[model samples]
Target: MKAHPFLLHKWQHWLALGFGSGLAPKAPGTFGTLAALPLVWLLALISPLWAGVAIVAAALLGVYLCEVVSRDIGAEDHGAIVFDEIVGFAITLWAVPFNLQNVLLAFVLFRLLDILKPWPIRWFDRNLHGGLGVMMDDIVAGVLACLLLHSVWLPLQL
Candidate 1:
């Protein structure tokens, strides 16, 4: 693939690239997830139910965005297609409190789960194809991170 096949002017490409965070020379996924922090903070400001609804909407849209960019770039899961990372991070902090500790913990956990790709996460990454495939593993990682936060980390803090 070329150094950058995605055009930032195109909304689909712009979003799929995580608002250009994916254009980073290295670790675009990490940068994309970092970019999601502001969105997560904004979501935390709203009702948890509404935040959840928004996340669901983003996830649904991410399917199309990932697919379009993947096809355009002729790469199944191009590193530049980091919409999955953004949505995944959103999912990770869906209803978590808006605080530095929680945010940092969620970030670390989500990145680890995403990067390590354990169990079913790895399974989805390997078995699936297309945009759904691009998004599934990160989705799973987000769920795992969220679960860890609510069930273990948060509880321990109490």
Candidate 2:
């Protein structure tokens, strides 16, 4: 496909930017997440309970948005569409005790699970299609990461 007239044509720019992250060639997903970090920080500052609600809302909304944008791009699950990651990461951090240790651990764990796509994530990636397919794996990853983070956090709380 030709480079979009506006930011390389199509919604590629929007998608890459996490709808925009697609604009970046190098580590667009990472850049997208970085862009999302400020939002994360703002949400984190809220009571953790509220943060959890927001994460759920964001993830559900992301599914629809990611699907629409992914369809427009004619690519199933483009890497530039990192809304899944954004929502996933937010969910991973939600309600978890924040400290350098937990933050680092959650980041590593979320990335690992997201990249690995274990269990149902693998299933969703392979079996599902469209935007839901693109988003389901990340949701799975977020759940796994959240579980792991909670497991770690519970011990620390004692």
Model 2, residue 36: distance off in Å is 3.1
Each candidate structure's TM-score, on Cα atoms with residue i matched to residue i, is: 0.94, 0.83
Cα-based lDDT for every prediction: 0.90, 0.72
- The C-alpha RMSD of each candidate to the native structure, in angstroms, is 1.6, 3.0
lDDT of 1 by residue, 1-158 (tens): 44677767789999999889999889999999998988898999999899999998999899999998898878989997889999999999888887888889899999999999999899999999999999999999999999987875567667
Model 1 alpha-carbon miss at residue 81, Å: 1.1
Candidate 1: residue 37 Cα off by (Å)? 1.2
Instruction: Return the lDDT, model 2, position 84.
Output: 78
Q: How many collisions per candidate?
A: 0, 13
For model 2 the TM-score comes to: 0.83
Q: Which candidate is the best by TM-score?
A: 1
